[model samples]
Target chain A: MKVIVNGEPRELPDGASVADAVASVTTAGSGVAAAVNDEVVRRSAWEATPLRDADRLEVLTAVQGG
Target chain B: MERSASGVEHEPQEDMDSLVIAGEEVGSRLIMGTGGAPSMQVLREALTASGTELTTVAMRRVDPSARGSVLDVLNECGIRVLPNTAGCFTAGEAVLTAKLAREALGTNWVKLEVIADEHTLLPDPIELVDAAEQLVDDGFVVLPYTNDDPVLARRLEQIGCAAVMPLGSPIGSGLGIRNPHNIELIVERAGVPVILDAGVGTASDAALAMELGCDAVLLATAVTRARHPARMAAAMRHAVEGGRLARLAGRIPKRRYAQASSPFDGIATSQ
Candidate 1:
């Protein structure tokens, strides 16, 4: 299924978890965090977290400022 | 030891109480950051423009491949460091990051950021309050980056935060005070210093923050990411000063009818 990650759509393998989806797309770097469909997935749960159809995933980093 | 803008000996102002945080008096109210600038030179120039004595920096693993050296730049500037736990979620995580920052920076001052939502990057008040209490108990001067909730502000203040930082809007959005009324409420109620942190797009936004009684402003993107970072930084510094002066000067009350600054009745009785 196609899942939106950071405003871009990427093809997700069947039964892809949040962790799997995140690793598939962006370069793993410092200060990264994620929200799945407006609900924040705690860092620990990112691995077990599963993606639903049309789930809007937003990945952010501590770029600068407050 | 106080130094004037021209590097002359200067005495600290008696009437203006230096911002007392963890028993240390910080001279400048403006707190800058060391991220998002195109280059280190630009970052240094922007910091100079802002006239900020305290600069916020994050603790990241030293990448051997990385080009910019935040330490060398910041050390040269001679500014006090304010480290942040920017991406921490839970109290435990934030506390850990704070400890690491203290160890790395050798300062007890921490900008505790417990983000609940990743999309908006808003602070989780529940987790934040919990972290603040723990950090304060652990003897770390906690400066929580939080939302513009007055009750939450009071709660955080009661929990012993050095300062309360309410967002003008989402981080890096540059929306410029989406909720000024709530910010004013936070300002009116907060016992600790209220710093309008994040989402300031322009100099006017910083000025507006000061006019609303905020003690300071913590911004990075508005300056670092601007087309002319140094110029924007200088503008923001002036805006902050002008707004502070205006607030001290006491603004005229708003009225339905125009009340002219010069007397409308008769000033030299124009023919």
Candidate 2:
């Protein structure tokens, strides 16, 4: 399956979950949050939520800003 | 009684009045932004010097290769973080950003910013009001960064914003308060705390904002980009305190003619 991760196109396994997509992009101990199709998917639900083709996943974390 | 090294007697320090927002009391009236610092270490020091109990951060896509510890620095200083939606242009975008920030930062407080354009980075009043309504409905304590307009501030407050943050000018413009009257109007009408956000060029600007009846002042670039970040932060702390004191002390009314300090009966004759 193909999905858009952080505005970039990426290939993922057919049954890839939000957790898998997040794991591919970030390392352990990194504090991050994810949203699928503009709706937030809680950290606990990442492993259970499945992504479909062309699904947009926005993985974000805190950064210095005003 | 405590005496200084120079043998000057010092008055007892009074407890600072707390700034209450959304039922929470923060110790400092100055809210510092985490942006514009050269590094996390510098930001940590500045945050300490400024004595801000609440600071701001923004949420963005996590970069795989990115390496910095803003969160760690904030945690180390025990400063609470208020996430912002800086680049969001629409209500939907701002709401989503706030949600994401809540999930990531584990806080329901959001500094909702919906910029209209890139150049000025001004808030779209329509969009901002819509977003504030939505966020409040969603049970988030929304602190909107709005323009220095009394009507807009009232609208936002009527929609149940925890606080109304009116910008002194455009974001990072360093122009200071452009319309003191508008700010005063907002302060007069707003039931919630009025925070002067943005357009603070220096310590004096921060002080003036407080003197104009703002409950608090929020700034980032003025201190972070200063030649000495830590020193500037300390100066801002004092400025906020001084301004609040002056405002509470009741300044004399402005007059066209000068009032003589000495009594008329005590005048000395030259002849």
Highest-TM-score candidate: 2
Give the local distance difference test score of model 2. Answer: 0.93
The TM-scores, one per candidate, come to 0.74, 0.94
- Which portions of model 1 show Cα errors greater than 4 Å? A1-66, B1-17, B261-271
* Proportion of the native interface contacts kept in model 2: 0.88
Model 2 C-alpha lDDT per residue in residues B95-131, reported as the tens digit of each score: 9999999998899999999999999999999999999
CAPRI classification of candidate 2:
high
Stretches of candidate 2 above 4 Å error?
Answer: A28-30, B1-16, B267-270
**TM-score of the second chain of model 2 compared to its true counterpart:** 0.94
Question: After TM-score superposition, what is the CA distance of residue B153 in candidate 1 from its true location, in Å?
Answer: 0.7
- Model 1 - which docking category? incorrect
Candidate that would win on DockQ = 2
> On residues B22-134, what C-alpha lDDT tens digit does candidate 1 reach at each position?
56777876788776888889989999889888988775433334564665677788877788888788987787667756644567899999998789899898899899999
